[model samples]
Target: MSDELPDSIHLVLVERLPNHIAVVTLNRPEVRNAINPAITSELGHVVQALNADDVWVIVLTGAGDKAFCAGADLTTVGSGQLDDLWTDDAGFAGFVFAKRTKPWIAAVNGAALAGGLEMALACDMIVADERSTFGLPEVRVGLVAIAGGAFRLPRVIPPAIAFEMIATGQSIGAQRAFSLGLVNSVAPAGDSVTIALELATRIAGNAPIPVRESLAIARRTSDLTESELVRMSDEAWSRLSKTEDFAEGPRAFLEKRSPIWLGR
Candidate 1:
């Protein structure tokens, strides 16, 4: 897999893990893995490639323990080149607002500020280091977190707390983020990526068809009425029931053996 990837992919590292999980590392640790046009473009390409691959789960993290991502490269904030960072299909960083059925987890190794926090918020789940911090400090610089931070934050945590964090431009500790349900779990220092991979492995062990269908329906109908959600779920189940894994699960349970999933 490494050899298949381009030699020019210096901004990000893509590793194919066991159990069909892909780990994508933001490699610019010298600047706290800050997002530049190069990073964004490389990351976008990686995500797009993985989405089409056979991988079931993706875990994203930074290269070093000092930071997950400090947000956009402020040095390029006003540079005309930064405009290239945005993709009509993937939004910022290529993951946010991207139409994806597979799950993604953010392994926050350190502080995730502004666009960084938004990137984490874009994932289905987040696992942060115990010493890590999260915040939307864009307000301090006369900017707002337009990369899904303002909207996703309020939905994940309480609206008031999300508002406070966005408005005050202050950061919150990992423990606080866990309490608010913003982070799925908190790992020991330097173990965030490990824990996130464990979580991804668990998800990958499930029936891929149902897992993807469930994720698609949940994300699509989170704002819909109960009846609408039920209708969607019913429709999804109708299709899922015809899948090979649906029959394999019952046969495996009856045989008291593990199912061999074909991801059909």
Candidate 2:
């Protein structure tokens, strides 16, 4: 893959792994995978390119085992360059509020706090290691989770627990997160990426168009009402009916053959 930004090759690493999966790894392990300006710009461009490519799944993780992300770089924040950590379209960390049609899985290797947790929450699903932790610790620093953690956490997990974490700036363990329905699965330490890739491969084997459409609607579950969701589902069906893979799915099933999705 071409590096959009010159220094991006050193900050963020983008790899096209097997099974049509593209893994975006935060490469600033020296800083515990903290988000800097270059990381924001590079990740935004990378995500945009992946969306236009033929890839089926995108997995995000950190390079080292110490942390998935430590949130914004304190050095940048202290240098008055905090604005660089955001894009006009993608928002904080080039992801929290970005519009993505494909399925994204966050493979949390370690602690995902503040903006890091917000990024995980932005993904369609999360695969965290048993040693990984999640929380919003901005309040402890006299700041707030402007990256959407304060609000998104309440919706992803229980609001009561969300408030406790948000206010206390304390993190929860992987097992507790799984028990609270915060993460899809918790693997053994250092196995989050492997498990997430397997899950992504399973999703990639199916039709891609419906999967993207389904993700689009499901992301809005908290924003839409029952009637609005019905309308959105109808719209998705209408859109899917025009795609070649939609019809191929049924034809292949009746013919007792595996469906070959054209990914239209």
Per-model TM-score on C-alpha atoms: 0.94, 0.95
Residue by residue across 120-212, what tens digits does model 1's lDDT show?
988889999999999999989888788899898999999999999999999999999999999999999889998999999999999987888
Expressed as tens digits, the lDDT of each residue in 72-176 for candidate 2 is 998898899989999999899888998887999999999998899999999999999999999899988888899899898999888999999999999999999
Model 1 poorest ten-residue lDDT run? 1-10
User: Model 1 — TM-score against the truth?
Assistant: 0.94
Best lDDT among the predictions, by candidate number: 2
What's each prediction's clash count? 0, 0
Candidates in order have lDDT scores of 0.87, 0.90
Question: Poorest 10 consecutive residues of model 2 by lDDT?
Answer: 1-10
